[model samples]
Target: MGVVYIGDRAVGKTHLALELTSPQGNYVRVFLANQNYQNLRANLLNLDGTTKPTQTIEKRSLNVEVRLPIGISKIAVDWIDSPGELFRRSWQSEHINEWENFKEMVGKSEGIFLIVPPYREILQPHIESENYVTQQQWCNRFNRWAEFFIYDCSQARRIVICLHKADLINCEIEQEISKLNYLPHGSPLNWLQRHNYVVNNYFQPVKSELEKINKSRSGLSVRCFITSIYYRSLLELPWIYLASYL
Candidate 1:
């Protein structure tokens, strides 16, 4: 199966990929075998705060064996990590071939991991700056991505809307979940309900837009998750969800 992780510049998509495919990384427990990530690890091993953004797309192949209700099934995953800027509209004109290649990859892929960061800190009070992207701007960007999938990648079966970098908003979310009068048994929907604030505050606009789009043309199985590399279990939830499809 083909899969891709899409996100904005500096939003941690590469970091998340590095951690997922790392042998010594926290997510090692989720994978039965991930020996082919050596090349990917070598390329990203020197990543740090000063690391430049990915300029070209990179692919990592793995035979992921996961337990299903039927039995053990091995899923061959061609995981693609692309340059964030390449997905933006502005870059489409500048990098024509790379941009088309990305769309083609998405069209052939079975799943997409849309990695998005928390917005609270992003929307915090700050001086007006050219680099600043407001919530509306984000919604616009995400909306465009949704349209791309709808029109360009109709073969995609699953869409994982990941609220990544959750470590940054974990405490506040826990407090909000604690205040809830009723909490259901564990599940993705229940988890979303428990962390309603994260949805309502951070992802509502995109969620609403997605709903509207889905109503018109439906087929995509959408799932949401609050992920963080700092929390191993949390980091693995999205992958587990993806595995369920297998």
Candidate 2:
């Protein structure tokens, strides 16, 4: 069993996957991008500022697998890091046949990691600007795509919503949770209950959107989580929860 990361461009999907699967430890990681070999290599080199003479990584599109031991047992995770920009733009094609083809390809994934930047709270403004599709349209497209992926793969329960760049808003969530507990009629005995309520409220809108998708995409389950690659402490709880699930 493994997890798949899906998000818009430069959302740190590759970086998070690498950190989780790094060889320095005992995690096995693989990268699957939508681009062809030549383009992938150029992007990596440009992003890393590596010298052309010392580029040792292969510039090819292949499924490379790695194995690592977890305590006495071993687990294999397959990671797919596709081009977010391409996926989003592919929806704008004029040909219905081509659009269906693209949708069919994405529907094969095991799970989805929907990454949204914390700084970009509302979806409307971002989607309305040039060089991007409207937020409403993006949500609709994702809903349909997710529905297809779940129906085809039979693994909709693994969907995870990741609020990336959450370090910027971690303190806010904490404060909000605390404040909710102290509300006029909030709970008195269970702090967890209060925290859960606060978290749910914070994500209520996204959850509603997901619910609309779920109606059509029936077997799929969606869960929300906050994550920040740059914040070590912010990741502790999420990692612990994931470890328990593993």
Candidate 3:
């Protein structure tokens, strides 16, 4: 089995990959940083803060792979972790090259794990110009790439979308409540109503966007899951789902 991470930069792709590898008892880990040949060579020489500190905490980096053990079966998982900030102007060349490499890896992949933050939509700019692309366009491009890979692979693989940082939403709600309380005549009911609107109108759209992307694709099985490292119960969903495939 193969696993690939697809998303914009700093979205916890690498972190999630490490978590999966750490739990699987018999797995040989490999790093495939989204750096040039020269940079990757240097990265090997500088192994500071690379390995996981404990079983609970997972490390995040550019790219990594792990070989899984399947008794009497020749089963293995090659995880391809790409850079999160793919469209940065300074790293455009590296981004394109890494994406090409990602495509090649996906051709042989049996599964894909896509990670996107719930609050990212609110933070990303809605810019459109010769030099800038809207977040929606970027998302569409990402979906298209995944669609192509899923289309190419013959094995019936699982596609999981990890809605990371769900806890952050709760935190944001609390922060808003605190801010509202400073008002001379603040009302808890009013604050709750405002926060509920934000949750329904803002974060809910993310689910709709993903469902739209999945509906357009054929043959591949897709599952959306909400997760937080702090929330043990939610983390189990992805693990249980992945195990079903094995």
Candidate 4:
């Protein structure tokens, strides 16, 4: 199974990857390192508090055995992590070969992990904001991706839309959550606390595009997740979801 991570630059793809592969404990446990995923040897941070964006493509593999109702199945997962710039319209022609390679890989992959950041910051219009992505702009961009997947990537069966940076979404509740000692993986209480914030502000804006993908492909599986690097289970579950089909 091939799973690729796709998101805008500075949205913490590298940071989230590191956290999943090299977990720190507060509330979350069952580290992915114990499950076989390892951190990449790339810079995760800048001098400032922002994550350093991926500049080139990177790949990793995990071969693990998962138990299913039928029996224990051995699965090998291929992860292709790439620079966010590859998704930009202006960059494609400049890096034609790389862009072609990227498209080819996605067309052949089994799953896609699409990371979306909190919309509170991105939805606010700022003419000078280099990184801010408006709702319309994001929707249009991802709609194109959806079209490509539907028409070209017939092999891609799972699309996991991860609404990352959950800590930044609801600051007040998160502060309260910070006081807690532990929270189990896939806790409904944790998701209930923040789902409305992300769903109404982030997911709703892109809902139409996502719905179109669903209607167009009967076999494709589309899932949304509210995730944070601080939460271990949130990051780990998406990989397990992708692996189940394999």
Candidate 5:
């Protein structure tokens, strides 16, 4: 199944891309093209500094295969490094060719990953400031974006909302997990519990919107992940569960 990664500019998308290209313990990334992975790594750093700004193109796509995964023979990934402007400018307003390409990506995607970074840094500021857009406004806009993507890609059975830079969050989720008595209060909660809380709090609304948009879409599965290419590696995580499906 092909999977696409969607997020605004500089939210660890390229970092995640490069990490999988390394000699992974669980899997290996096979680039369909002959482009050197080393050059792409350097390009990531330059991209971040505006030295090489991402162009407003349809996509910077790479046909890749994460081969010999734990539970599967191979996982083919048609990964695209998309422009932040597509979502920022609301491309559907004009129904441009780029927007059509986006539609094609969503239409063909079996799984989707939406990367969300810390609000204060990538999105809006945590506190109100003079000549700055309100945090609530930014939130509303993001929510709309999520709803729109989910609607357009409603048929995608598996969706991953990746919360990037988890260390930067203002209200630590671990602290909030304390107040809830229903979920088994334990020292060092497992991934399932954390994922459930995070998804319910953030992704449920978007899932609901998706259902509303396409009432007939069935067996939809959306997962929330606290993903960091730095703090932790996804390769170590039991992706065999996901690989089995592929």
Candidate 6:
């Protein structure tokens, strides 16, 4: 499957992709991007779950090709890890060559990982009021972009709303959880942890938009995945994105 990862900067998009595709000895990984990273291999493929590079030169996107041997047939998967600026600048603005490249990738994508920050971060307000308003408008535009890919792109089969930075959310939930242990039996902490309240709240807006797409498209699927590159393993099974792809 051709999977493209799109998200704003510093949301751990590249980290998650590299973590999922790290050396299993069954795949040959290659980079097709034109930009240079300070320490791409160590930063991305860190086994200890390191999520940040010393410094990134800030490229428009990072492209990866993973060739996996499925029996005798070697299947190649192309992943485009794009910077959020692509969407920020391209929205209601000039569609530059980079934007065109992004469009083509999305057009040919079989599955897409639209990465966004955690619930609390998403709910946080922009410092500038005008920028906040612009962001809301851009979100609508992004929804339209998503609609185009789902309805018009024949190869687009699935769109997964990936909630990035699960580690942070887990910490938040745990902190709030500790205070509730003194309460009566059957405290809300149990429900919050069990139901994945942070992720569920963050996914609601995307779910509402894509529920229509799911209904309209006979075979198209819109789903959600919560992930964290920092955690050694997952508290919940869904945080492991490799399973989602394979």
TM-score between model 2 and native: 0.52
Clashing pairs in 4: none
lDDT of 6: 0.49
- Candidate 6, poorest ten consecutive residues by summed lDDT: 234-243
Whole-model Cα lDDT of every candidate shown, in order:
0.62, 0.44, 0.47, 0.60, 0.54, 0.49
Residue 107 in model 1: shift from native, Å? Answer: 0.7
Instruction: Kindly report which residue pairs in candidate 2 clash with one another.
Output: 127-134
How badly does each model clash, as a count of residue pairs? 0, 1, 3, 0, 0, 0
Worst 10 residues of 4 by lDDT: 25-34
Candidate 6 all-Cα RMSD:
9.2
Per the 3 Å backbone cut-off, how many clashing residue pairs does candidate 4 have?
Answer: 0
Ranking by lDDT: 1, 4, 5, 6, 3, 2
Q: Which one is best on TM-score?
A: 1
Candidate 6 clashes: the total is 0
- The candidate maximizing lDDT is 1
Model 6 residue 139 CA deviation (Å) reads 6.4
Once fitted onto the true fold, the runs of candidate 6 whose alpha carbons sit more than 4 angstroms away are 21-39, 42-75, 88-95, 121-145, 170-202, 232-246
Those runs of model 1 whose alpha carbons end farther than 4 Å from true positions after fitting are 22-42, 45-51, 62-73, 87-90, 120-132, 170-198
Candidate 3, pairs of clashing residues: 8-84, 9-84, 9-85
Candidate 5 lDDT over residue span 1-246, tens digit each: 467667656666667666666654344353535556677677666745323445664345554443332323454555555565666556556648777777788767877766765454233345433423244554665576656655677657666666665544455544543432222234244555655766565444345543443353676655566555553233223232234344
Error of 6 at 13 (Å): 1.1
lDDT of 4 by residue, 193-233 (tens): 34334455558877777777767766886766666777665
lDDT of 1 by residue, 125-189 (tens): 44233444566777877887777777887777877777777656535645433443221233334
Better model by TM-score: candidate 3 vs candidate 4: 4
> Residue 227's C-alpha lDDT in candidate 6?
54
Task: Tell me the tens digit of each residue's lDDT in model 6 across 1-246.
Answer: 456556655566666655544443223233435423334656454676555542312333434433323222222345455444454654426646656666776777676656665543343343323322243553565586566665656676666565666555534644433432322234445423522453355555555565676776676766555556554232122322222343
